[model samples]
Target: MGLINMATYLDIIRGTYEGTSEENGKRLRDALATDAVWTEAAGFPYAGTYVGPEAILANVFHRLATEWIDYRATVHTYVADGDRVAAFGTYSGTYRTTGKTMEASFAHLYRLENGKIVNMQQFVDSAMVRAAMD
Candidate 1:
């Protein structure tokens, strides 16, 4: 069997951060498996588990879009092995509720199956978010 490469993972990451437009969202959906699961770090306002593309879109993506202005994940480094990819980045946005802006480091781990992302876990500085919320 051939091994999964990092390029594909990078493509997914690139597409995800480009924007939240419908076409961009569609690219993200196409890269995810039907039963994909996304776990957000605890302490985050949207902290929870999201299953499937629809759930992820509704619970996580939608919240981000509605609650934050110019929310973007800017990746700085990428590490990959086998079907797993670890992306290090920063997330910057302005919280709608408080009109507070924040820039925090983040890491996202992705596991792919059949060339599609099946699982994802996010790590971020919750303190930064809390500060903004406060």
Candidate 2:
């Protein structure tokens, strides 16, 4: 398959958040190459760089499973060009560890190759999270 258009790419990203099942996660994984690299900005305690699909599944998704009672991301804006898509959104959830509920802004940059995500970078309002925990 070749590169998917920007609208299609946005749809896929939205689907990843909207679909509430392992199947969705699997679908998202399928769209990602095995060697994909996912990086999150510093400041957020759980933020770290993850390489490969398996690493993201283990470190990012799995960690989210334990930390949040419920988590959802709402897209505020999306821009795409060729094989790259950038999304801005807010993630809201209840922190399982401290029972602190939060809604914070975030932005993600995704690079796709042959219809699969090969790299991703994320930025979140970690300072707000830190204050919420205090």
Candidate 3:
């Protein structure tokens, strides 16, 4: 019984940040609840509240792919509290336009329901990301 593959909040959330950008994106969309809300931090390049997987894929995933070269989120730690999970990590990449590189710390919070992410919030130092673009 204990061996059952019950997915924890952190496991569901880790799917969103584990693989390559494209692969991780697929996992993210797959783990999203029907009305999931994905919030990008204000001042972030893709800052906004995206409802549903489609919106998030279009606004955040697609833009990141096109605007940044080799962009990635590497999670160093994961903390789970009941239905909530927090991923502490770093973002690194080179801006397509500027060809400058950036490494910024990030924290992603997720609330899951029935093994799917119902809400998510992003926290990061936008200035560090902006420095690379400029």
Candidate 4:
């Protein structure tokens, strides 16, 4: 297993957020291994622990698409050390159900191994999101 560069990992994450094609999704899947785990801290509406790259692809990507018409994440700060990368960002989207727009700040800690994302934990402002939905 080779060490994955932090910048490259960030680029992959950025691409996943910005890319709108099926090819992009495929690229993300290629970047991540089959056993990758993604977890979100408690408090957010979608807060729960998810395991496996397939789950992330399904719940984080597919399920989100159902709730949001257009979603995008903008990175504010990113720091990497060893095999872990931490990113602070804002995620903005239009809710498909109400057509309401919302933006929330978020932080993510990612662990990489063998040039693939092995684990990810996300933290977001749930109160703000709940207020926006109200």
Candidate 1: segments with Cα more than 4 A from true spot? 1-4, 18-23
Prediction 4 global C-alpha lDDT: 0.76
Pairs that clash in candidate 3: none
lDDT sort, best first: 3, 1, 2, 4
TM-score of 4: 0.83
| Best of the two (2, 4) by TM-score | 2
Model 1 lDDT per residue over 1-134, tens place:
15656777666666765665676788888888999999999988789999999999999889888989888888888887777888898988999999999999999998887678899999999899878878
Query: What are the Cα lDDT values of the candidates?
Result: 0.85, 0.79, 0.87, 0.76
lDDT of 4 at 40: 73
Q: Write the per-residue lDDT of candidate 3 for residues 26-96, one digit (tens) a residue.
A: 88878899999999999998999999888988999898899999999999999887778899999999999
**Which candidate's TM-score is highest?**
3
Candidate 4 error regions (>4 Å) = 1-3, 18-24
Root mean square deviation (Cα) for candidate 2: 2.0
Best by lDDT: 3
The TM-score, computed over Cα atoms with residue i paired to residue i, of candidate 3 is: 0.92
**Tens digits of per-residue lDDT for model 4, 13-110:** 66655566576678778877678888877977677877787788777778776777666667788887777878889978777777778899999887
Reference-based lDDT, residue 27, model 3: 83
lDDT of 3: 0.87
Error of 3 at 113 (Å): 0.8
Better of 1 and 3 by TM-score: 3
